[model samples]
Target: MERVPLSEVVSDCVRRWFQDSLKEAKAGDVAMQVLVGQMYHSGYGVARSEQKGRAWFEKASRYRSSVWKVSNKRPGLNASDSDSDEVKENIK
Candidate 1:
């Protein structure tokens, strides 16, 4: 999948989608957290902040570790469970 450049993702709806994903990330959705990290890293729909991106990525990694303890499988960072095409696109 081709990535949508951050400069090209200026739509309000896209921004809202990222905001919603961030909310889900805060709620312990590991995949969403990674997506949020990607967004932050690239400044796709938010201010670019490598520190915040790394933080989110670390959070997601911790969550994945917890999940692995229970399921014996890591929650891999893939777009399989994404609800938005934009997420799928950006996550790749």
Candidate 2:
């Protein structure tokens, strides 16, 4: 899939989405953390900071790990798992 350019992202909406998803009642969703990481990484809907990006990416990894440990779980339908090392090397 083609990625949406960082410059065009709606920062406010992304912020709102992340905040709302963090609420206790809405905490069931796991993708929010990943989206937050992506926003930080690309500065699409947030300020650009590699430290922040890494932090969020770590959070995403943790979320994925948790799911994997539960009920034989894996990435969900909308989850954006990273490509394999082989695929990444090929693209370089």
- Per-model TM-score on C-alpha atoms: 0.60, 0.45
**What TM-score would you give candidate 1 relative to the actual structure?**
0.60
| Model 2 residue 22 CA deviation in Å | 5.9
Query: What would the per-residue lDDT of candidate 1 be over residues 1-92, giving only the tens digit for each residue?
Result: 99997766656766887889989999988878877777777776788787887787778767454321222122233443333544677889
lDDT scores for all predictions?
0.66, 0.49
TM-score of model 2 relative to the true fold?
0.45
On the 0 to 100 scale, the lDDT of residue 83 in model 2 is 35
| Candidate 1, poorest ten consecutive residues by summed lDDT | 67-76
Off by over 4 Å in 1: 1-10, 65-92
